[model samples]
Target: MVSITFLGTGGGRFATIYQTRSTGGMLIEDRGRIHLDPGPGALTNMARLNMDPGFTDAVLISHCHPDHYSDAEVLIEGMTRGGINTRGLLAGSVSTIDGIDGIRPAISDYHRQLPSRVLSMRAGDEADIAGMRTRFTPTRHTDASGVGAVFETSAGTVSYMGDTAPREEVTASHEGCRVLILNVTRPFGARLRCHLCSEDVPAIVERLRPELTVLTHMGVKMVEQGPEEQALRLERMTGSRIVAARDMMRLDIGDSLRVNAPTLL
Candidate 1:
């Protein structure tokens, strides 16, 4: 079985600065634990939720933005037992692996040395990590080197649209995923460059038609407008199963995805 846990759901500058929502990303549990993004408060959030960073087998960073990769190195240390054991895979984009266009590399040389394998990926690239096939997908973002990710796991194909503006390539790349996670940072009609707004969800959902669509990485405006209401709006517009991600929200994916709210579960 495959399960996903959202450690944080906040996105954009203001939300991250004030922490209107947490920036720590999501955790995927299957054959092993895989931490995605590990942004600010990742370790703290994980600790609060009783998640052990030391057991993480892989860390996937989609970009170099502080809100996405700030806590990566610390997690790397946890995964490697404070450098005692050099084990775990670190996969990320060119900008994240090697500084690009003046954006500093997110992972330092010291941390890079600790991971058993460090994969510098680009759009169309694919990597096989512990039996799961991960394919890099294109993105339109300020960080030109940023890319989305799709994982073909035992349960099904899980796609993360990283931080990107709505693009045909993004939709097409995530076509076969059973679970699609999008970083929808704004409410409908509040379009922003390089980030998704609720207005863009319907088309993307229609194009990909994933069994489950999760909206996450919400900005201040999205939070103020109510992510759940926005999700319902998107569902009505696209006839797709849509849910707004909340911190620590978990979902078990099998033939069908089952959402397990922390309070309820």
Candidate 2:
């Protein structure tokens, strides 16, 4: 069965200190493993969890933010077996792919040449990777062009909200998605800018009404507040099964995602 692995559940730079958990993001393993948003501790966390980067077929970045795209180039090298070939797909936002002020061309020439195909998109653009379909969905945050990705996998459709405040169009992009992964950085009570609070989850759940709603990209505040309890609250309010993600957690496709732990390291 197809499965999604939560490599990291924290968000922002502070996530490093909150290393009791990880903030790297998710991995979708179907016909091939697809890593999304390889943040600060992604590769390391994967190793800790006993998952291999060389097994990946593609890496998708939502934006150029350090917490979202930092380790991509390094991960790419692993995927290509130390730059021996350019076979896997590399998809990222425009800013993430092309450097701005010489910052984001993060990967070297040898690495960029490894992807069999590379797609640089800002949002509202779709590309087919092998058999999986990916669409760059729009968001309200500022990131050169502000983009996120919606993956139409063989199992089901998923919309990963990289970073953004609630926007009218964000949910519509994945109108009938079965899984929606949102970067919920705040707890049930706090109010913030360009980030989502637990209170905002029900609206998304009611609107998109995905089979399962995943709360990710959390922060220390949320961690201290206890994401698990807040997820339970969100479920109570939305009447949808809501899950607060943990680093290295795995889930299979469908309304109820079965959990699997990486092999003990």
lDDT of 1 by residue, 1-265 (tens): 9999898999999999999999999899888888999889889988888878999999999998989999999999999999899899999999999989898889999999999999999999999855578899999999988999999889989999999988887788898889999999999878889999999998998988999999999999999999999999889888899999988899999877899886321
| Residue 37 displacement (Å), model 1 | 0.5
Model 2: per-residue Cα lDDT over 64-111, one tens digit each:
777887789889988888888668988877777776654556556667
Candidate 1 C-alpha error for residue 47, in Å? 0.7
True lDDT of residue 229, candidate 1 = 99
TM-score of 2: 0.92
Worst 10 residues of 2 by lDDT: 256-265
lDDT of 1 at 131: 57
Q: C-alpha displacement of 72 in model 2, angstroms?
A: 1.2
TM-scores, all candidates, are 0.97, 0.92
